[model samples]
Target: MAKTTPATRSLAHAGIAFDVHVYVYDPGAERIGMQAAEALGEDPKRVLKTLMARVDGKPVCVILPSDREIAMKKLAAAFGGKSAEMMASADAERLTGYHVGGISPFGQRRPVPAAIEVMALGEPYVFINGGQRGLQIRLDPRAAAQLLGAVSAPLVA
Candidate 1:
């Protein structure tokens, strides 16, 4: 796996400290995030998943733990919208310029409103996609949230 990616470059440019971890990606896994957590031998709560969603028709990015599911209503409230739904995979790929299971909040094709689950922010460190499959970036969750301008909210169900 290449050590550099748009996600890593973005963090480097911002001077945010992070570490890269590579694992065998299981494309057939039922849940990509959980697969990643198990492969990395880390707690599911410390492995965050990036999700592309729409809030009242406007695009938004959401980050939450591998073990949790986002509450759509709470997602909408987080972004001050009345409704929310996950974006189509094709749309998410186009918007983020990343394949499914490899999207990263740090370096998207376009920047959108982003939110990080409040519970995740309390973790000492969290692993997020590194803009590529099989790659993960570990960093301080608070720093990650700040760098993404992500709102901290109770997004999980």
Candidate 2:
């Protein structure tokens, strides 16, 4: 197992139980999320991809299934914002203190408002980035939402 990152440590500190999954990362892979899913031999639907966005000019997170696309309008509505747009990769990295492909919903330098894809809330378990490339954390979806303070919404289409 890899050394504990902020994401895992935060979950641990919160007394949350989860499984750590590490897999080889193919830098040449076309999509980071799909790469992780394939490498881990898991359904992409059960894996999540974290995205940074600006909602009404505030940093926010949108977590959704690897195979899904976020609906910007729904995301904005979820947070009671008039507008929401994906943040530039560089800006996202700067804001969350994690590189673009490694952003986790947990353990941000400054936590932000976040929303989860509605369907993810009901999954038995979900795998998400672990604050770095090649590491993933699997946990009960419900617990993750609570820990992330993520509101559930139809953010993905």
Candidate that scores best on TM-score: 1
Tens digit of lDDT per residue, candidate 1, span 13-84?
999999999999999999999999999999999999999999999999999999999999999999999999
Give all candidates' CA lDDT scores.
0.96, 0.90
Q: Per-residue lDDT of 4-27 in model 2, one digit per residue for the tens? A: 888999999999889999998778
Candidate 1: the clashing residue pairs are none
Clashes of 2: 0
Model 1: lowest-lDDT 10 consecutive positions: 1-10
- Candidate 2: where is the Cα deviation over 4 Å? none
